[model samples]
Target: MLIDKPLPELRRYRGRNPRPADFTRYWREALRELDATPVQPELVPNREIDVPGVECFDLWFTGVGGARVYAKYLRPKAPIGRRHPAVLQFHGYSGNSGDWLGKVPYVAAGFCVAALDCRGQGGRSTDAGAVQGNTLNGHIIRGLDDPDDRKLLFRSLYLDTVQLARVVMSRPEVNPDRLGAMGASQGGGLTLACAALEPRIRRAAPVYPFLCDYQRVWEMDLAKDAYAELRDYFRRFDPCHEREADVFRKLGYIDCQHLAPMIKGEILMYTGLMDQICPPSTQFAAYNHIRARKEMVLYPDFGHEWLPGEADRTLRFMLPLAR
Candidate 1:
């Protein structure tokens, strides 16, 4: 049973969510603030996951608000004269940078890999937690009640992605022109955000991205799982939906759909029509706004979980850039 619009309609779907009038200006100012912040980066060698051809290091950098960010960095051991491409990875919501072994393939493919541990999640990265609202279920609602949009948790998280890109691009062994990004679900959303905020990202692969079309998800009554916090916030704070417009408007500050138009990188989105956790329509809401060279791999019967060979395909999609 498909849970969203059919493929034909999905192609033409423009989404029902409202894009804030000052969306572009808001992000421009945010990035300006992020750029002004001092990113004092540090790298320490890690022996636990060392392998044959890749050097593993614990990467730390200061992000916006002075919170420290963490990432697992693997630089490939190529000839001294050779410069390698790099990939920045974002993980699913509430998750950390995955085990070191998972990044080996990219390292073996002559790519330096840096997987981020998002702020306040299941990773070593720190969450400053100075918001004004319910900090209960999800990061989406962390600063919803704050008078200032700068206090939003996702604002900092999104800026963290940009800072990591800057860090990776600064490496002497890496080619800044060949940097790419990959992630699924929340990571997928961050992938979009990173590419949008960091124009240097040349390629992006986002699988079933979350944090898009929040109003559409709410109207469809599908805000239960990863979006459960959205529903819970309303139930507890605005029981009668008095300030609904303001709530969604505030969320616009972090919505990936609004950010999509800023992405200049080539995009390849992986989506399953049956993905209830992040519905197909919601995924398309962001995809439709992408003005870059882009394509989508549709899984007609798949859900939010793994799609067979998706990893292989993504690797192949990025493989051409190695040359």
Candidate 2:
């Protein structure tokens, strides 16, 4: 496991980041804002992919702060009248909803699929850029300098997942009760967040989620690669570590570990013990806090990269939703 903690320790980890006292109230107000913002969803037919059994479309919806979020939507072609099970797929950080062909397996299994393209990433979504801080390095610290913690970019990003879920659920052809979500890395974190914010999510599979235990990452000095923004933020904004506690306290608003307890769905989390990018302990921090029906798949020899048979296992885990 290299420098990663032992399995026993990882399982018991509760995370090191501070949890804001008003964490629940903060999200309540955020949800209130999302409720007021109209999600104007539009679907444009995609003619490029020549798949036989599925229909594809470019789905667009207005997210929080009036940003237009995009998702690649696909559904079975033959089953038109009845509603079908649905799955929401989120991508890794700085990435977009992948090609339409990749989502065909769910459609083939008679499931409606929507893969979100996070705002301001490598996709069609638009970033409002309305925050008041340094936006140079990454999304993590985009709004750290703002007095209002609501300005945090991840707050809006997390709310976008909820908005997307609502839009998918509103579709006449989607069975809301059978809805599931799955993702890796940043997407994994968003999966946890989505399931947390929207209790309607029936199943969730998050593979080595990021955005948990920020202070732990910094403390361990593993903030170089995916968490480089943490190092950058401290160096550029608070070099003297003066506002260290306050900074992490504000970040507590977006940490996935704090949000895990809010999930009401069944969860299947995957963690690679040798992962330095998002260390195993950090992933377990959120996983351990989940109060819902949950299970974990640990890869003893694996790291942040791909784990063998993960795709097949994920497909099988989510297959029950199709019933």
Point to the candidate with the largest lDDT.
2
Candidate 2: residue 236 Cα off by (Å): 0.8
Q: Give candidate 1 misplaced runs (Cα > 4 Å).
A: 130-136
Question: Model 1 misses residue 181 by how many Å?
Answer: 0.2
Model 2: per-residue lDDT, tens digit, 1-323?
36767778877889999999999999999999999998999999999888998999999999889888888999898655799999999999878899888899989998999999888777778886743222335799878999988999899999999999999999999988999999999999999999999999999999999999999999999988889989989998899999999999999999999999999999999998889999888899999999999999988888899989888888998899898
Q: Give each model a TM-score.
A: 0.96, 0.97
Pairs that collide in candidate 1 are: none
Question: lDDT tens digits, residues 1-323, model 1?
Answer: 65788788888887777777888888889999988999999999998876899899999998988888899999987778677899999999878999999999999998999999988878888776533222335699988988887788899999999999999999989998999999999999999999999999999999999999899899889989899999999999999999999899888888898899999999999998889999898889899999999999999889999999899999998987788
CA displacement after TM-score superposition, residue 185 of candidate 1 (Å): 0.4
Which pairs of residues have clashing backbones in candidate 2? none
